[model samples]
Target chain A: QKEVEQDPGPLSVPEGAIVSLNCTYSNSAFQYFMWYRQYSRKGPELLMYTYSSGNKEDGRFTAQVDKSSKYISLFIRDSQPSDSATYLCAMRDAQGGSEKLVFGKGTKLTVNP
Target chain B: GAGVSQSPRYKVAKRGQDVALRCDPISGHVSLFWYQQALGQGPEFLTYFQNEAQLDKSGLPSDRFFAERPEGSVSTLKIQRTQQEDSAVYLCASSPDGNTEAFFGQGTRLTVV
Candidate 1:
């Protein structure tokens, strides 16, 4: 089984709607969870990062991780057309450092105006 | 400061040919990483470098894949005898340290036909 699993969502939402993206991992050792946004033809950009199981809010985005469930989520509030892109979840064990990020297949999102 | 930068934004090579992709990490970053992203898939770990030292390379798919960070500032990933399966986007990222957030490059899209 892949260490990380995410829905390959081509999820479509209207502008101003709320968007929620999620991922699950089997590795209990994972301590750092991150969310990344990738536009077509571009590399992923860091969106949200959280250490361990907790919630972190940044601007219009909120990242939540439940270590107990090995699940993590990213919620985008008041989404806009510019927000359409692929969202990816990545994680690593606390001891693994920044070099060993394991990533889940990204969820594609399209926000129509 | 600039984010990570990669050269040859796009490459198309015939099967059995060799290809070399380059990455310039953010200045002074202590950690560098390489990842491969196939179509519709998230990025997968390839190799890592801490300054001039190659720390972990277990993620590389085969012996044909090689990466080097000779000066600790710029890194290169070379694929010898590329196969069709080698077609993917090669992404490079760097962080200030083992625990810091990583910044990614625009990535080099490689196609082995």
Candidate 2:
């Protein structure tokens, strides 16, 4: 099984709609969960990060992690066209130094105006 | 104030040719990372450096791929005898420390034809 799995969604939503992106992992050691946004032909940008299991909110974006279920999610409220991008979920074990990140195939999100 | 920067934003090389991609991390950052992103996939870790020391290279796919951060600030990923499978975006990122969030470069899109 892949270490991390995500739906490669070309999910289309109208502007102002809410969007949810999710990923599941098999590794129970992963402690740092992150969400990245990537545009076509560009590198992925870190959007939200969370340590362990909890919910973190920053502006219109929220990140939630459930270590028990090995699931992580990124929720975008009031989505806009500019929010269209590939959403990637990545995790790193708490080994404390330069640990490699495991990533899921990103889900493409398109918010139509 | 500068984010991570990469040179030769786009590169096209014939198969079997060698290619070198450079990355300039945010100043004073202590950790540097290299990742590869194939089309429609999320970035995967390649190697990591803590300052000038290469601490983890377990993620490197093969001997043909090598990365170095000789000066502890700027880094390079060199692909020897590039193959068509090497066609992907090479991303560089840096964090203030191993436990911090990372900032990524725009990435170098390498196409091996």
Candidate 3:
């Protein structure tokens, strides 16, 4: 199986809605999980990063990881039009493995005003 | 530079023509990486570099693809006899350390026709 798998979603949500993006990985060695936002013509920008299992919150965004299930998720509360973009889930192995990140096919989000 | 920078934001080359893409990472960053992003897909790891030493290149598709960071700052990815399949957005990212969050460049969009 591909290392990381994410649904390619062109999900449309109204303003002030709650949005959730998720990814699954088959590699149990992956220890670093990250979420990135990418606009139409720009590169991916790091958003949330977490290590191991548990939850991390930053402003209106929250990241959760479940090592046992090998699943990771990003939740956006009160998502706005500005949040309309592609969301990419990326992970890396423990330090000293491979520094290069493994990414999932991004989910395109369109938060309409 | 303030962030990772990449040259030739957009490039169009005829099939079989070689192409060279450049990346200027953030100063003092120890880890550098190259990734390929195709339409509707997330970026895929291509290679990784530590200073002037190329640590991992197993992600490269084939021998026709090569990358180098001769000076430990400026790097180049060269695709020899580029094919249509080689057309994709090439991205460069860097982190202060090998195990931290990374910053990405605007990316070099290569279109091989």
- List runs of model 2 lying over 4 Å from the truth: none
RMSD of 1: 1.0
Candidate 3 clash figure, as a count: 0
User: Tens digit of lDDT per residue, candidate 2, span A36-112?
Assistant: 99988877888998999999999999999999999999999999999999999999998656667889999999999
Q: What is the TM-score of chain B alone in each candidate?
A: 0.98, 0.98, 0.97
- Interface RMSD of the predictions, in order shown? 1.6, 1.3, 0.8
Write the residue-wise lDDT of candidate 1 on A1-113 in tens digits.
99999999899999999999999999999988999999999989999989998899999999999999999999999999999999999999877443589999999999999
How far is A4's C-alpha from truth in model 2 (Å)?
1.0
Ten contiguous residues minimizing lDDT sum, candidate 1 chain A: A91-100
Specify the poorest-scoring 10-residue window by lDDT in model 3 chain B: B94-103
lDDT of 2 by residue, B19-63 (tens): 999999999999999999998888999999999999999888999
State the C-alpha lDDT per candidate: 0.94, 0.93, 0.94
lDDT of 2 at A3: 95
DockQ of each: 0.73, 0.78, 0.85
| Reproduced native contacts, each prediction | 0.74, 0.78, 0.80
TM-scores vs. true structure, each candidate: 0.98, 0.97, 0.98
State the lDDT of candidate 3 residue by residue for B1-113, as single tens digits. 48999999999999999999999999999889999999999999999999989999998999999999998999999999999999899999998878888899999999999
